[model samples]
Target: MNETLPMTGKMNIAANDDWWRGAVIYQIYPRSFRDTNGDGIGDLRGIVKGLDYIADLGVDGIWISPFFTSPMKDFGYDVADYCGIDPSFGTFEDFDAIIAKAHDLGLKVIIDQVYSHTSDEHAWFHESRQDRTNPKADWYVWADPKPDGSPPSNWQSVFGGSAWQWDGPRRQYYLHNFLASQPDLNVHNREVQDALLDVARFWLDRGVDGFRLDALNFSMHDPQLRDNPPSGVPMERVTRPFDMQDKVYNQSHADIPAFLERIRATIDGYSGRFTVAEVGGPDPLAEMKAFTEDGKRLDSAYNFDFLYAPELTANRVRSSLSNWDGTPGEGWPSWAFSNHDAPRAITRWAQDGDVDRMARLSMLLLLSLRGNPIIYQGEELGLPQGHVAFEDLQDPEAIANWPHTLGRDGARTPMPWEANAPQAGFSNANRTWLKLDEAHKERAIDRQRSDPGSMVSYTRELLALRNSLPALVDGASRLLDTPEEIVAFVRTSDQGDVLCAFNLGEQAIDWAPPEEFASARMVADQDTVNGGNAIRDRIEARSGYWAK
Candidate 1:
């Protein structure tokens, strides 16, 4: 299991050095992180400029959002060139420089790999649509129309309308689980999997430490094209329309892990490079388990367990974590409280002006849990959700569900780097893609970077503390007998024993640290709270804590 140090010689990863396990990963939404060019969009060069900020957070590595070449109809998810960087993001050379600099700074690099679909502009798809007999024709999921010229099935596009788009040249329709432009790849096709594997290998060869596979569960589809069953009284899946139904037919394909295994083998070939899948759908936890189970697939996977919850409560946290309670062989999990794709937890669970406490407690909870943690950009600074007007919105999902919900554009706003700088120091462009969210500026990273009481600083302290504690990183968790609204657990390792507690209620509750647990000391984070409510011992209203 000894890995050859690529820094010292021709490379290969060391399995035992599996750095991803319980590692703290920072997420960089490249487009909104920083803008090097005045072109009003963030690019790879912007990411390079922002690396110092990312490194200062004490992250083990970063998961840079997609920078792949694309038409950008769906941002970079509709990739036209898998192995190439988009002109909007920067050239491939820019990406290489970023990777080299990150490694030199002793940080691991994990970039996004969108294997589920491609832009219609992709040459392969263009050729496939030109005629039915083309070599790449079967590479995509093309279907004949049902009687009377309707779609082959009742599937709906994640963006808003029919999932099938007409291609005049071939006189057929192609399936897209998301936007019509971002067509799903036929992962069921062995050829398709091989091509995608090559894309991954290309990055591995380029020295990427790992990959964050986007929408992995959507890669394969049901050949039958059956209609999805309804969830009853159409509802939003967070902010996306695709959540209205059970999503049974469009995603969570049974054969996905079979393909994931191939992807696993590709990553395994490289040595230490890691991988984590972004799995979302009905039964995401089960799908996440299958994708990472028994070491046959990804290193770990993230779901909406914590992201979509209405409030950050001790019991809710307990219920979410308890669901994954399995033995050693079960698939490992990666936890995220906020990300570019979802609303910020502060906005999702805030009371009065206590959002700051919620931010810290959420991180403490995330850090104490038994999983790899992905701290979204600005979450460290305790950034609250921003407001984006309908005129400034870009997310299709947000636009479709406007007024009812604030839409995802509000959460996906630009990162605030400096409170005093114009536009919160994100860019100087006369007109950025989205307007600057007023509230986020005051909570910019630079303003709180040095403040010990700041959430950003708390994040650093907790991560540093966790790094020194073996139990926190590789421990087994067991629930302490506590009330349903209070989440308490113990994480044990060879280093020692550590116990955690959380108060997830609207009212306060007194809690006592267990005095009989061998030699237990209040290591750190003994009192966790949110919005005046104790999340740990006293169980502050809407708060939590971590103690040992």
Candidate 2:
């Protein structure tokens, strides 16, 4: 770790409360970002050391994944202590240093808040399972089993088994939407909600800027313990039984929005604080909107529309963007093509094709959209998915459904920083938590730091350009009529209108801009426009254009 980095006091940037709108947030999976100690795992000190690099990316903020005390059952997702930093990650002082360094660099810091469940090792869970009459007995979702000793409901765990785990002491079953070790909380209980709110106040009082609520829809469930219905589709080649069910009773309870309102009220006390929820399910759009509805809930919500997408198409982009039309009282949306849980977009979309071109085009499109765009760590470097063998896998979901799904381990590999340094400059230890991919070494930050054509450089340029244009920042967008392979949209604002177009196909075609944008000046492009004009008579394949 570089100990020389200064940890200055917080310095506020001149921005309004709505600064998060159209802002670019870069997500850092702390365990994979950089390792400071010889333990081969990244920590808070490592994040402090990398603040300058992150600030240089032109992103407005950084969202660090969960680093709270955990049992490592789900790689820090199963929180054992919501207020304490895990010793493996670092100390509370180390976390404060990160907040200081990030704010000093003009970057806001957002940490993950996992409130849906807690690790079975947590004191709350331990005490709740001891007896039914304890003070915290109803803290978690518990139900009596059927006379035949069956689970309370037919719900399935996201990690492959039943969502209920039997507690011998209580002589009843407990709900766990994810791994059995991660027992779901009874968020409907007022006492439980108050405790979670106290956890939020703990972080907010510590000078943290915001939170990315994890699995928020799973925070509340049906109190009746009703069974989930079939998905109404064939379950051919399903890896987990959870995919076969509609997940109605297990998650997305109607009362969740009221709890979200409580969360909003808590954060609203702290000025300039932001909150975005991570919602996923069969029908996530409605839940997402409910979670981020106008002034009562979260500030924004991001779904898995693009994160879990099998492929990227013009129609898919059009349909996804069309859902959030900026209507009155509608909630804002956040967009991400890659994250710690999903495979890199380049690997998923550019299979057997030119990855470099796809990376640039994807970056262009993400920044061109109306919603806030989140760039995952190493995404600016165009890092592809790393290959983790069966024996080396650490994800419980991946281990449970082995050989069938390319688990999230591939995308959680350490961030490569040097081309020739040991462990790709991620660590100096003999071995890291997850092996580094040799292919990533060539695309390391050291190699691309000075290369103008590198993905990192291109990403920085795009972010700067995006920041400079109000039409791209907080403008109203409208889709244009185009061919099947072409997607064109216009963003209108008080300053001006910016036209964005992209070719999702491999063949170049003769295309013309709408009559209004025919003479617009080209502000950014991937070799798609000619001589400052938005386009010539033709646009190249795998290219994008942004004009004002």
Candidate 3:
């Protein structure tokens, strides 16, 4: 690996018309992002108020999670209407204002499109479940019961229990990959696919720049309703019963790609529009590649490769990057260490006292990668996971699984904007929907925006550095040989070659620079060594550097 060779064949993503390639996208979970009203729920206007703050971060775009009409059972993920905005989130006029403000700030707005399922309260689902002969009767996944009156298959819901739910009027079972209220759409039906495509058209026409397709792989299922095979893997900790099976028939369906082609065609009609699918399962890389394989599919896709990893290591980074090799016709990959669905990265990966240092290093590491990097809101502040008491928990997963899973509520806690203001300036209300992470007040945006050495300020510098360098933006990355404590790689392009190195361990270790990197100029970095194996050459704990 030390042979000093040109790494993977270089593929310039920007050469294509896709602007999302190698961009840094800030993910804003609508409810937790900011709340402008005293009603305690975040609305579109709240996001509008924060646009300038987001733009100043130097990111290329913003991906706002679901804000559509919903029952709030699964939060906004359970969509009641595709074209309408939920009242709690604001009106369509409020959405228009958000679109206008985001564009004025030169930030592309990517809204969530939850095409996999719809809330039971949705008009379509409501009509479809009524006596089975309605105009939209086949709009959802409805199946007949077996001779024994059991569910059609052994499929399981992601939340727990059988995937099939009995509908009283239809007298048949409807498949739901999540909560029973969230009935999976029958993408096999041409009308359903067309309707979803129209939903995409509705947003595109509304001036939204892009979409973050939620659970895109789960949009379709096997029409046969075959049972998923058992993985036979021993369960050390059964967080959910869904983990028992391989999830073959219920998701990652064969027909999903053809439907994606249709979605892509609709998006292609609108110039400069982008689409990224969020795919997750036991094996997501293959599906991620398939979804974005060609220019005709989604612009990019991201899986839980890093989001759900138990640990962060050099080998893991190298392996994940290798999968996306940046070869011609290969789809672009996106990476996220934390999001609304998972626990905070610092709490998950860093040692107790090393969060601040690890946060800086993680920012550098993420920005230096080969593809687009998604920064979860408050990540710049280095917010650790909040401790949510059992009685205070609103997340169904946390409540059901209890201590087994970390649950998503911790990451979805309200973002702290001010250190002393009520609810950390998230709202003027006496109470917010979810409690603000009190520990995050110390790392609030107001506090870090002023301190030059703060994590938030360092994030700005890192982004600025990344934007200024083509090697960091769209270059081909090749892993370098390093000791177990270090994760090192080289990004090469016509602009130049850059060596990126990180110390993952918690000790200040002596490491000698390779001959070619010895006199390399410092481009962008954090807590790196100074000279050679001498005392000055020791890289501090949880630090990294980029040199060219």
TM-score of 1: 0.92
lDDT of each: 0.77, 0.87, 0.83
Model 1 score (lDDT):
0.77
Task: List the candidates' TM-scores in order.
Answer: 0.92, 0.96, 0.94
Per-candidate clashes, comma-separated: 11, 0, 0
**In model 3, where is the ten-residue run with the lowest total lDDT?**
1-10
Whole-model lDDT, model 3: 0.83
- For candidate 3, write residues 1-548 as lDDT tens digits: 11221212112332244667777899999898889878877878889888888877778789999988899999999999989888998988899898888776667888999999999999999899887788899999999999999999999888889999998899999999999999999988999989999999999999988899999888888888889998766788566679889988889988888988999899989988888889998688889888987787888998898898877776778778878887788898889999999998878788656787678778888988898899999898899898788888999988998888889999999888899988888888887888887888898889888887788777776776676678878789887777888777888989888888877776877876667777786666664322222223567777778887
Residue 70, candidate 1: C-alpha displacement in angstroms = 1.5
Q: Which candidate is the best by lDDT?
A: 2
Ranking by TM-score: 2, 3, 1
lDDT of 2 by residue, 1-548 (tens): 12222212111122677778888899999999999997899999999888888887788899999999998889899999999899989999999999898877778889999989999999999999999999999999999999899999999998888999999999999999999999999999999999999999999999888999999989989998888998866767577888888888889889999999999999999999889999887579988877877768999999898898877889989998899999888988899999999888888898557778778888889988888899999889988888898988888878888888778999999999889999999999998999888889999998997887788877776776676678888889999988888999999998789999888877887888988877788888863322366356577777888987
TM-score leader: 2
Displacement of residue 104 (Cα, Å) in model 1 is 1.8
